[model samples]
Target: MNLEARKIEFVQEFLKLQNEEAVSRLEKILRKEKNASNERIFEPMTQEELNKRIDKSESDFRNNRFKSSSELLAKYE
Candidate 1:
């Protein structure tokens, strides 16, 4: 069936659920998923933008401007 029809069917079945604990668990899962989706911040970058980033990173590496993993970890820690 279509999306709306599927949603209605799900709601009907969900309403038939009699276990409060099960419903509460499902509600928590759905809320967590919704919150996780809302927390996303990054958008997809264009190929040109990606290329510019790669070029900049390569230049920095060649100039010894980049930090090693251990250095970064130590600094952050």
Candidate 2:
């Protein structure tokens, strides 16, 4: 069946549900599916953008511009 017809049928079946736990479980599943779809909307960086980031990182390393693991740990402590 088409999407709208399927949705109407689902609603009809859902209305007939007598179990509260089953409805709650279906609600949780719907929420998880929605959150997953939202997460999939994020765009990744292009290869050129990635290369530029790598180049900047190398320049920072050459200039001794980054922190050390010990320095970072000391600051947190």
Candidate 3:
């Protein structure tokens, strides 16, 4: 009924698929889930975006930006 249960059911159904076409479909479904999970775990962060963000933060610190490290830590945490 829930997400985890659905995932397990998907795997069970995938494993049970006997026909070549059915197995291919199941493989596609599994691949899609795998890609989605991987994307969520390791999101694309371009070098430029990372560099700009770091530069902005370093400048912010030099300029004595708001409050404290706790604020920054909250963003990263």
Candidate 4:
């Protein structure tokens, strides 16, 4: 790559190590830009939707949609 690109990449990696908050903010900005580029993309889920999903996940676990680790290992063996 070009010298400028290499410099920018190094700065980004260094910032990721030295300033995690900056790195996280940069990632958030990039994700928003990517989502904005796609008009048909769905909006972010609301708090209510997230709570419902969490409840459903808990229910699924209680109903054993996920098998035990020992059972998984036994099946593999």
| lDDT on C-alpha atoms for all candidate structures | 0.94, 0.98, 0.87, 0.86
TM-score of each: 0.48, 0.54, 0.39, 0.35
Q: Pick the candidate with the highest TM-score.
A: 2
After best superposition, candidate 3 residue 59: deviation in angstroms?
A: 19
Estimate the lDDT of model 4. 0.86
Tens-digit lDDT string for candidate 1 (1-77): 99999989989999999999999998999999899987796589999999999999999999999889999899988
lDDT per residue as tens, model 3, 1-77:
99999989977877887799988876798899999998889877899999999999999989988568898899898
Query: How much does candidate 1 score in TM-score?
Result: 0.48
**Higher-scoring candidate on TM-score, 1 or 3:** 1
**Clash count for each candidate, listed in order shown:** 0, 0, 0, 0
Off-target runs (Cα >4 Å) in candidate 1 are 41-77
lDDT of 2 by residue, 1-77 (tens): 99999999999999999999999999999999999999999899999999999999999999999999999999999
* Superposition error at 23 for model 2 (Å): 0.3
Model 4 per-residue lDDT at 29: 82
Clashing pairs in 1: none
Please give the distance, in angstroms, between residue 74's alpha carbon in candidate 1 and its true position after superposition: 25
- What TM-score quantifies how close candidate 3 is to the native fold? 0.39
